[model samples]
Target: MMERKLVFGVAVGVAVGACVVAAVVVGRRVKSRSKWKRVVRVLEEFEVAGDTPVRRLRQVVDAMAVEMHAGLASEGGSKLKMLLTYVDNLPNGSEKGTFYALDLGGTNFRVLRVHLGGQRSLSLEHDVERQPIPEHLMTGTSEDLFDFIASSLKDFVEKADDPDQLVARRKELGFTFSFPVKHASASSGVLIKWTKGFSIEDMVGQDAAESLQQAIDRIGLDMRVSVLINDTLGTLAVGHYQDPDTVAAVIIGTGTNACYLERTDAIIKCQGLLTTSGSMVINMEWGNFWTSHLPRTTYDIDLDVDSPNPNEQGFEKMISGMYLGDIVRRVILRISQESDVLGPASTRLLMPFILRTPSMAAMHEDSSPDLTEVARTLEDILEITDTPLKVRKLVVKICDIVTRRAARLAAAGIVGILKKIGRDGSNGIAGGRSRTDIKLRRTVAIEGSLYTSYTMFREYLHEALVEILGEETAPHVILKATEDGSGIGAALLAASYSS
Candidate 1:
């Protein structure tokens, strides 16, 4: 009886131990479920916040048009700096001359010599030399930076095939300085501020064309800075050179901006301004554009707060290539913080901009059955390994949400430009005109990697345009891609305005 009792007690203890183990296992599964639920909630919230339904996009379009009008009405009237570029004539291919162009937009600058053959589109020749700006020079003195550019321009000109052209007459150059410039003339513009990693204090409020001219003189180069324009104008010039119907130019690249041909009378700030064609190009520094209609989320807020320039380039932060990947990163980081589904907290995910836009695009466009590209990108960039198929799918959804919003917002902006010109067929949101009454063939010159290289982005933008303008009206508005606008287009402008 004593032996049996001992055996029964031992068996009971063993049974109790097994039951505790099972309870713990069940508890862990429940906890995992809870964590995953939180992750899903976060994603759902992001999606809802980022939703750009047709109605909301139309609001954005109207807001953009209003801001454009306000900006054109007066300086400092709105966030949009409707700066005038006194370009009365868009090049019609009648320009026949050997002109030089110096493009200083991003980290790299290029010098080009373009030879235009009096006729249209038949004989335009160019030779380009590109050089990366040195790191120290970006923050260096204005004189030093200009001197470096002038030195490069000197070297580029020495190798030209037709040296006689330089000796026969003073070389005219169009300076495509892709920065915020406030000026009154086509030949010169004052640097309002520097963007694209340049911060030359002395250059601010100073004439950029004059600085370049002074440098050219110091370096013994015989070149005249004939026209001062940004890359947007360059794109417009190049686009109009190819097709006269191109009325506006848009840049959807690392940075975002647009310039459009507007009637001289429409610019109310400069009331008596006159142009030969009765039209002028207005640089809509649309990157700094902001209105309450824009959809802002926690991710965008955090990204902007952490950015070097907070409260600036608000629209650019949402739509430009520079900030898109980082925005996606912020979303993924939040998800990781909320759940262990993505495995142990990836330290790299905490880092900013480690996952670039190209990588994000790769992940978003992954079409494999198993989403192998998404898996690889996560592994390679974020150091998150072995993500299950479901997790990969979730990542893809995040990318789509972010990119789709950006593309749609960009499309709204395009429509806003059309509306400002009375070519969008909406007639300033009154919507009273018949299709034929407002139907017009309008072409917008677009340049940059976002529109040309990213297929998904391009498609989404096109889709939004169709949704906004409808099938019949959308067909009339064209988004044509213009190449080498900053390089060759500037050369063409120099020829047109050359002395």
Candidate 2:
């Protein structure tokens, strides 16, 4: 009886032990499942976040439109200090002279000299020399960089000796310094900030004219930076000097900006200063404009997050040359990474930003037989060798979306400018008194590489303008490409100041 009782107790204990072991195993499984569920939720959120580049791009565009309108209709008046700079000092009728223009745009520097006659014809006596900025100098000290430029100018000057003497006074030069500057006068301006992939350490507070002059002087060259101006200001000056009706200038390239003539009286910001002609040139660093009415995408947001300056220049980040190709790359990369549409692995583009603006321009203009242009451009830019036709088509679609979005938004900005100029309306400032009855005839003198190089950009921009302004006034509003307007325009500004 005792033996049987002991066996019964042992069986009960064994049963209890088995129950404990089973409970522990079930609990562990349940905990693991809960953890996995949390992880899946986070992953889903990420996927959603990454899929909204279009929305983000639109948001940025809308912001830019708002800022553009504000800058155009800036405080004192809807006028952007739109003053016609007089070229009083240009060689009088029937005189001949050689003028030099140094254009310091992003990515490259240009040195050009023109031979002009009193009969209103100009010829390229010498071809312009273009030199890319060395990798070291771009990120080097200001003095080292300037010294390099000075040396280049010295070389260019040495090349200027003529076999046949042309009688003229000291040569005058126009320097197109494409950067943000505070112009105290036409002869000089202070560099406020450096943009355009340039980050030289010593150039922030230096006078741009003085820097160029010092470089020239160091080379023992005898020429003056007679016209120190930004490219937009140069465009306006050159446009107005060429034709008085040309009142505004806009540059849409790797970056985007606008400048126009404005009345001195309208600028309440500078109450104490006196302008002899009651006007000055205003540079609308309009890239920072932000508002609604634009489209944004997931790729755009990703770009903004990765950009150097986040939450600023939201509009430019969306549409400029520097970012458009990058956006396309990001979108393709995302689609390749997540979706089964790409078939297999992503193209191993060794460089992420290699798909530059020019490549984008090339892809956009590609119309070769069998769409080989598009295929070749994609391969060249992304280094994707032997890409299948399917992938090529996908890339082309992405390019289309990006380009169309940019063109459409760019049109909106132009329309906003026209609206501000009152070409579409009769809401005249001062009830259409004081100034001439301009009567809604406005001209936009455009300058920049993208404007010049892109195939259908101009047409699409015009289409958008027509959509906004209607077909009637679209013809009345002119958008013409002003070649080298900035260089000559700087000299014109010098003349205006000297006068």
Candidate 3:
């Protein structure tokens, strides 16, 4: 009897322990659910479902067109720069002979040589070399930097052939200087400002083409900068070479900008400018474009406020490849703070730019049954662990939301350009012109890693265009991918403008 009583006591103890464990588990789950609900509330503010309908997008399009007009009217008139590219003539596939191109857009520069066969056939040979600009040189005298570039070019030219090509002829080079410049002519422009982390003080208010030419002369290199063009103009030139119908070009890599052919008469600020082609390409510095129509959440506002250039490039902050990953990190950081579902808030999440766009793309494109890639990224980037399947799915949902919003906004911007150019509706850009007179086919040349490498982003942009334009109008517009056309296009420009 005593033994039976002891066994009953043991059984009661075991049952009490089990109940205690069950109660603790339930309490933890309740707490987690509360946190999750808070995260959902935060996400709801960023929802683009209701904010970006067709009607709202049309308003954005209209705003963009108005801003373009304002910008073209005067300097510093609107958020859009609307700088004139001075490219009156695009490549017509008749460019012949050998030409060279020098691209100085970033820390690394590219030297390209093209042998034009005429009739749209050509062979290209190129060498990409990286030379880190010394920290002092970036802020030093303009001559110092240009001299460095010229010396590098001399080295590249010396290695062109076995001493024969070096002395063959004075090579004409198309210089793609990707910066804000006020063009005096096709081969001359004054540097307006330095961007992309460059801060040369003396470079401003100086002739960019002449500086490079002087540098080349100092180095004794027999190269003439025949045409000075921006990267967007170069890309457009390549597109025009391939297809005459191509009227616009966009670059969506680390940053976003576009250029398109504009009637010379529309350039009200430059009344005296003349070109034989009767049209000019205007570089729409679209990154700075902002409007109340853009759907902005607290996250986007915070990003802008905290950026190095606050309240600048607001559109780029929302759309470009450079900032997308950081935006995702901000969202995840908020989620981690609100919920222990992802364990604890990570120190890595506090760091800026810890999660790059490529990694974000990988996580968004993860197709594993368990979402192992998302898990891995969380672990690797944020040091978060033990995330449940549902939480992992939530991360994916956040990515989709951010990516979709960016893409749709980009589509709206593009349509705005179309509306300005008289391609969006049946009516011409003049507002009252007959629809029957307008051609149905229009092509836009696009370049950059985001459009070409990120499959989902491309799809989202395309889908948004369809939604905005509808089935009938969308079919008439095409966004053609032009790979590495910037270099080739510059070479073509050199060939076209060679004296």
> Please, what is the whole-model Cα lDDT of each candidate in the order they appear?
0.90, 0.63, 0.84
- The TM-score of predicted model 2 comes to 0.73
Q: TM-scores for all candidates? A: 0.91, 0.73, 0.92
Q: For candidate 3, write residues 16-134 as lDDT tens digits.
A: 99999999999988887788888787677667432577777778888988888888889988999998878788888887777888888876677777777777743354555556677
TM-score of 3: 0.92
lDDT of 2 at 72: 38
- Clashes (backbone N, CA, C under 3 Å), per candidate, total 0, 28, 0
Best by lDDT: 1
Model 3 spans with C-alpha error above 4 angstroms: 1-22, 48-51, 121-136, 162-169, 437-439
| Order of the predicted models by lDDT, top scorer first | 1, 3, 2
Q: Please list all clashing residue pairs in model 3, or write none if there are none.
A: none
Model 1 poorest ten-residue lDDT run: 429-438
Off by over 4 Å in 2: 1-96, 106-108, 118-127, 131-169, 195-202, 215-221, 347-351, 368-370, 378-394, 425-440, 486-488, 491-499
**Candidate 2 residues 1-499, lDDT tens each?**
9999999999999999999999999897887566445434433443454332434433433444344344434453322232222222322223345666788867778776665553433322434778888978878887777777778866876676674423334556788888777776666778888887889868898888888888887877766777776787777765665556665688888888776655555444555546665556667665665554445556677788888888777768766888888877776666555543334554654345768877776776666645687777755555455656655665666676677667667766665554444443333322333233334567778887767778676666676667655566667778878767655655444444432
